[model samples]
Target: MTPPPPSTGQPGPATRRTVLRALAALPASALALGAAPGLLTTATAAAPARGYATRYTVVPFLDSSDAGVSVYQSDDATDFRLIKAAAYTPPANRVRDASVLKHTDGRYYLTYTTHTWQDTSTTIGFARSTDLVNWTFLYDYTVPIMNLSRAWAPEWFVDGDGSVNVLVSCSTTADEWTFTPYRLKAADSALTSWSAPVALSGIGANHIDTFVVRAGSTYHAFTKNETTKYIEYATAAALTGPYTFRGTGDWAGWGGTREGPALVQLDNGAWRIFFDGYGDGSYYYSDSYDTFATWSAPAKLPAVSGTVRHFTVLKETVTGGPTLPTGVTRSFRSANYTTRYWQEQSALVNLPVVGSASTTAEKQAATFTIVAGLADSGGCSFRNAAGNYLRHYDFRARFDAHDGTSTFAADATFVLRAGASSGSVRLESYNYPGRYLRHYDYQLRVDAADGTDLFRQDSSFAAVTAWA
Candidate 1:
């Protein structure tokens, strides 16, 4: 977007029942979110995520009006294509709210819930696909007694124990809407055959779909709550009965309503959850610690730039350890300079203010803050001047963090006029006690020093506050 305004630099959690609230609106969101060859099941993708390498591939979608599914792909996550000019006609009135799961067994699964022709009974069902193209329907029924017929947005997750779990938001025979998150254990691949659906805690009314996953030893479920969606984490050392509901949150912000919760674990051991917002158009984004972990603050997906289709970390088993990117401090450039430090990385783009005095009459300036870093242990001091410490001011934006979530950076524009001097600005990391948390201070804190902040305050301030 306009080259992001020349990189002036800088930037910036949730809970449970908060979870139930989130699940409440998921079904309504999924109808708009899925239904290709199969369902568009989202995983509890990992946290500390790295951008995807494989470009966006064409995935199919069912158009209710066309009575069939359509296919499209956008190498770039935002744009879509009309590769196959056709739609998939389902057995029912409209096969809405579909979620596809690309499982660990290398097999893909699709699940969805919709009503019949007369628009009376709605049922949750499953299908299977190997190449993500053709799907084989596994199950479809009327509603309760195998009766309520008001179910919507169905999600399926296979846990570490090979237990197939299904969660959905449903309404009662009285038309009372509620989150009917369920778990079903499959004795065999014949998905049609399953144990009785065991419903978990009912969260408010209106919740209709849910996506879940497992990390460590617990299960993490996210759903569309009211007004603002939320993330809920539950633990079932065993797949049945006593599912302990211990986590809840709306970390993704309460102002802009969000829905369609999806979770995944990151390569770095953290977990991230995503959802779509209603009324408001930003995507909900945030993360947690472990399977039964609480969420941090959630960030909004940018509207100016089309939202990312979906993000998944491609993990590969490697020998030894990670080879981090090389860091460079001394950087000179054609008006744009970026470097990596211990906590964050930032760029410096020269914004020329023509006229006034002359080229030699100008001087450079900079400022900023960090989200999660070393905490209490922060300091800033740059080279006073190349020749001597001028009558210039000593300025800096102090920051010390320990949590990696909501990391931030901010900088200002430097004004260098004639008779100005050349000197470098720097900030020092005083040894921060306590591990604080994993990866707390491991990222690069871009523009943490005054040299970077000297660019623009409001832009950096806005970016820093963008997530939290």
Candidate 2:
């Protein structure tokens, strides 16, 4: 069946009796996890310990050919690998826009839209799974509204007080469609009982695929502006109410065609928004340090194996802190001047230089690593690739081979300061409070903060390994 367009919206009218019969007729063996490993089996692969917050995003998607729900899992958010193909087989011939929510009790509830554009009586389907691989289909339900032709992209957000909020895109008209977001609240896991659907105001008409995420004290709602066909966002202090529209932009990579936006926060404190390129069968993402005020350019993610549409991401809580980069040597690339590297040359009388390197091997000579203490601690020394330590002579920074003397320890220590650029860090002299390691006319030196954009960018350096 074709996908329903904005105009001529329709709803599926599969009865509760039919749904109950289908569930009862299904064999127990079909739902049981037998000798073979289940699709949603717990992952045993050990992830690299980077001391960063680890998150597992479980994506529920539609396998259009099989007319079923499949699942994928991601540790890094950007790279989603298939976990269970066709984890939940729908009773209908087609289903789309799947969202999986992990309940407080650790079970997962998946919701999706059943029937494609061909059916007028579209319904929202439900399934529950203790382990994501195996799903038991619950009864299908429709919004208790007159002439509600379509219900699409149902996503759930559990509030702090334990109430569940499900945001759905729906329309009531026949010839002209005015798709809008509506909220349905449920207090218990059954999900059979829900509050009457209430229209989410502030955002204009023709908006759909509503996904909300809470950061700090504020809640942000990401929705697709169907009239404009671009993903936009709104924010509110409370989950239900007065959300201020925060302008429209194409932060989800490809313009016009991108929709079904989802969000996840990385352990490094960066936020990412994932959007589906529905026409291209790809997913695009953008990064932001600020809370949706600004965003990085959209980049494409690795393609999922099969045809999929409209999914959600969930971050799993990780034990322990982020894996710190200890004893790891990294080359420093200048943020302001991309081609420049941090270098030390004897020809300039041991002064550190920030200049272009001619070859790949020469760039290695400019690399340095933290020694003695944690990289973030001010007690760390910068040891270059040549096995020489960076130290200061009379407050002037220079690289010198260790002479097995205590003086080397005192002069070499520096503190890492957060840089103006994202993912960049600045080195501040341990002895000087306001002074930072900065490039002065391509020469590396310790200087006081100039408080200029150029100076901040010049002082900032992104640490990278050879293979990163």
Candidate 3:
């Protein structure tokens, strides 16, 4: 279908048509991953279709200057309704950013961070709301955050260890000065008693929007680089220490700014991040104030699967040759003798000799080799443009999944053929070293979404010796 004009100018809620289109496309085959049995809605045998609204009026709060710690009931862009605003008054330390979460007890926790004056404190605060709107402040930690940039990006995740932690980025200095990344743990949801703000090592010194998510037993923290104009990020295995920096190359320039990354690992082996960039705001849009005047895409919040009737999709592909069976002898992407690594890719590929190839087929096989390394590869993930689904391959990228465990950061990588025949091809780490192959299969899935061209293999083989 001729995709509707890219979402522009419209705000508040998504139009009804948009909603229907997106809803219709939710793949019923997707098996819910990580989430409990009923966390996601199952595709009905047959169901209704609706249009996406033009304006999702569900604004957590009514504010043009960016309200903080809010929730708005919305489906797409057109029809939106805000049920409540932040119970805490917005004084000199106006709102910064927020996240709305639901726990096992049925209590909704609104964990968000505030930007203070003396320093950008990574403060954690919350309120309870039965209906996303109308919040009641249960905790206020905005004050006394002078040590760890005061906690700027305060996102909450239930670690795999079964403990809840507030994943926040820090800027050691004040917001007016400089900043860095840090993590503060909560004994439970009790904001009053925190495990103390601990500085995450490995990150050079300055990073913005520090958030972490859980994947199995490890943790993946997402961060931004203030040192360079181009986008950059870092990853770490644990929550509070030793993060490795992957420079500009991995900075996912997909969106102009590439900062403030929020991630969710959906079922079907997809890891998606909701980030802010140019088109959505003035700071990043090429036409707005301080405009870069380049083809840079704007930094705007991506409309989640819940907000769109339909989503825009951009596809990529790698060919036999740059000119197809002609130009560029850059070696078959999977033809491996040395070692290879990629994040996201398109369609698929034909396996040529890669590792220890003696014959045509041997040298052509795209065998994936995986090693149990630190999950700190600043890799990338593929997107389904239409759905809120993503496939994250980077091990070290910090994720704030609200899931507790030591297994969220980085796992292992599996090497085999292309498609997961019988849909068995998948990777995920949940802690325990017992299931190495399945735990890190996605590690070998390099290159972002490209047109199909890969070998389908079984779990027994890490190095593809044959093709299907």
What's the number of clashes in each of the models? 95, 16, 144
- Quote the positional error of residue 43 for candidate 3 in Å: 17
Instruction: Give the alpha carbon lDDT tens digit for every residue of 287-344 in model 3.
Output: 1111111222332332222221111111111121111111111232322212332212
Give a tens-digit lDDT track for model 2, residues 232-279.
Answer: 778877766578887676653347656677776653345666776654
Strongest candidate by TM-score = 2
Q: Estimate TM-scores for all models.
A: 0.49, 0.60, 0.44
Where does the lowest 10-residue lDDT sum fall in candidate 2? 32-41
Model 1 poorest ten-residue lDDT run: 431-440
lDDT of 1 by residue, 1-468 (tens): 000111121210112122334446566533222111111222332111112221223322331222334444322122233545333336655444455555666766656555432345456666666655566666674434345546655566556656565555555555434445555545566555666666655333444345555555654444444433443434554433245555555343333345555554432234545555543435544545433344445545322112222222112222322111112122211111222111111221222322324233232212122222112111111211121111111122222222232222111111111111122222222211000111112222222112112221211211111110
lDDT winner: 2
lDDT (Cα) of model 3:
0.34
List runs of model 3 lying over 4 Å from the truth. Answer: 1-63, 66-70, 73-93, 115-123, 142-149, 172-176, 189-191, 229-233, 246-251, 278-468
Off by over 4 Å in 1: 1-91, 103-106, 116-118, 133-146, 201-208, 224-256, 289-297, 302-468
Q: Candidate 3: TM-score?
A: 0.44
Instruction: Quote model 2's TM-score.
Output: 0.60
